[model samples]
Target: MKQDRHVSPSVINRLPRYYRFLRDLLGRGVTRISSKELAELMNVTASQIRQDLNCFGGFGQQGYGYNVELLHKEIGSILGVDRLTPAVLIGAGNLGKTLANQVNLSTRGFRLIGAFDKSPAIIGTDLVGLTVQNIDSLEAFCRRYNPKAAIICIPKEAAAAMAGDLISWGIVGFWNFSSYDFTQNHQGVTAVNVHLGDSVMTLSYLIKHMDGFQEEAETEDDA
Candidate 1:
């Protein structure tokens, strides 16, 4: 594994994919996997797989390959899956509610300790076992829970202010889906901006290009 502090973001992004695939292998009762086999499953070259894994540390043996469970545990440790990071959710709107209900934050290292919203209709209501508190109570709640991260699901206009408030309360990271670019304004905060519309547009572009590719292939076959 590469020991350098300046690991590329692309490598960082691929770590989660490796972790997920290892998890699936574990579920299937697979005991071990070679770099070549794993690479085939992930659709990457074996050398690339080795390079990415080397960024952390070598886990595989020369001929024995990697012990599936051990490698999975090591990758999970690297990814901080066991950190149980406390997090708060701002905005108890549709997206926020869906995330709370459907997503298992703990599986990914985060624990949802508080959920807040400005709307009186949402505030004081139960959201997936946690009561939605008034936005006015965010600071107090943050102080009490001491969350390390905040999940922003509010409108674009309100996201920045909400992020500022969370930052004041000692939040160091944000998972933002508000269509606002938090990192552009916040200099030192670790923010993951989720743009659903952009992802859908990308899918549309791929579908259009795929159709064009199929037409060209068919024409060549006809010739």
Candidate 2:
């Protein structure tokens, strides 16, 4: 299906969660799902699901519901999750090591081709089955592996420099864990900032609101 070229970025963000849920439903032998079911699962209104689906071309009916397998495939293709993406991680610091150990890279369509660090002691060590290569090997790895993107886990001070280094070596996209504002010299490169503090603050707001809700519910029960 030919998708509309001008879909909103918010819609794009919702695709991954929708795709994951649809994939799960399919795996559980679910053939069809109502928009209401999706909306409840995703914490949105049924109309919202239907509208988003319609933005990418319709997938559901008024009463019969949507075909789970078809929705999964469409979302996968739209988000580029259907294809494998080669990636690398730089800086073997605490945060870097944490990210490395947290996920099994073999699943999830991400191939961790290599890791780099400036520490001489850590160089040549093994991390997540890939040997830790020195920062000097960055260009070589980019040439050999030709990864689509890289994760910058180095300190804030080193972020810009490492990003430039990656850019020099043909890394077109970056998942920047370092809190640095990047100035892109190349037209194709994209840098996504992953601010840990902002995420924590968001979680804190949720916790506070949930506590308030519980207090209100207790008062209502007393009444």
Candidate 3:
């Protein structure tokens, strides 16, 4: 299936989830599935599944449903999982090391080409297979490898300058673990600032104010 330039962000965001479910289906040896069946598994409407897939192009036939393996492959292609774009990490802290070792880089379409840090202790350490290099080597390394993306795992105070340096080095995409917000002035840059703290706070809110929790507690006490 061919990608459309003007697809909605919501649809774009759901592509990975769709890709994951399809991959699971393929693993289960399922050969084909109707939109309704896929939607049920995804907790969405059948029409929604059809509409989202139709954004790229028609992949289903009248009576044949969708070929599980082929659909999974095509969705992965659309998500750029086959691209393997070169990527680098700037901060070799605990979170950085964790991401390096745990995250499936190939499935996400990135190849970790380099890792860098300013601390003397971390500079020589091994993160997965990549050696943690001195921060001084970052610009030169980026120039050599021409990494298109960067994973920022530094503190908020230093994120701005780091972003500037990366932009100058021709890095256009960022997976920022810091809280810094990169807005309009970034030009052609595409950044996803992942605030782990904010996510925890969101979970806190969900637990503290969850619907029917208070009533359930009262009923339990009475029981």
Candidate 4:
């Protein structure tokens, strides 16, 4: 049955939010939930949820709602959050240390099991609960621990070399925080570039548009 079930990336992205909402509803002792309720919580149309779920085969009745417990289990299993995904960090700088400290990764199926760095000063230091092992140990660490994913926050100049090493060590998924372009190794790994400057620019654009919209709304409200 699991082999027959197919999930698109868009559907995969929404599963965690749905799972969290279902957990909240269950805590409130709610048994059944309508598609419209889910749509409202996720700020999407009711038909969208229906369509996404229908892709995996229909579950709810025509008038009645979905089973809260069953939906939770289904979404959890689909997103791979039911079991822990071993993860590691490949730097010990400020950005790397901050990512290492993030606790919500486990709830989303990722666990920060270890970290590495080139600095002798930072190496052997404890980052949260995980120690900052030397960079020389990277290959051995990956082979031994077999992490499902890794976060790369090394310097821009060092990122490509590190990425090459990671690929050689069988790391296919990467959350790259460096400023370098990973175009060369794009085919070999799943890389997510966290560009802080680009993110700030996006925020500024949203804030400008939002301010104009608020002004228009206030004018209409006064009229």
Candidates 1 and 3 compared by lDDT, better number? 3
Counting clashing residue pairs in each candidate, in order, gives 5, 0, 0, 0
Residue-level lDDT tens digits of model 3 in 173-222: 56555433322223533322244454411111012112221111111111
Question: How do these models rank on TM-score, best leading?
Answer: 3, 1, 4, 2
Q: To one decimal, what is the Cα RMSD in angstroms of model 3 from the true structure?
A: 16.1
Per-model TM-score on C-alpha atoms: 0.46, 0.44, 0.46, 0.45
lDDT of 2 by residue, 21-138 (tens): 8866876899998998878887999888887888878777667999999889888777775365677888877777777788554354465768999899888887865678898878
Stretches off by above 4 angstroms in model 4 are 1-82, 178-193, 199-223
TM-score, structure 1 vs. true: 0.46
* lDDT by residue (tens digit), candidate 1, 11-123: 99898788878877986899999999998998999998888878777788898888999999988787776676777888889989888887666644576778999998998
Model 3, global lDDT: 0.71
Q: What is the TM-score (0 to 1) of candidate 2? A: 0.44
Q: Clashing residue pairs, candidate 4? A: none
lDDT pick, better of 2 and 3: 3
3 or 4, greater by TM-score: 3
Kindly report which residue stretches of model 3 are placed more than 4 angstroms away from their true locations once superposed. Answer: 1-82, 178-193, 199-223
lDDT values for all models? 0.70, 0.66, 0.71, 0.65
Cα lDDT, model 4, residue 68: 83
Clashing pairs in 2: none
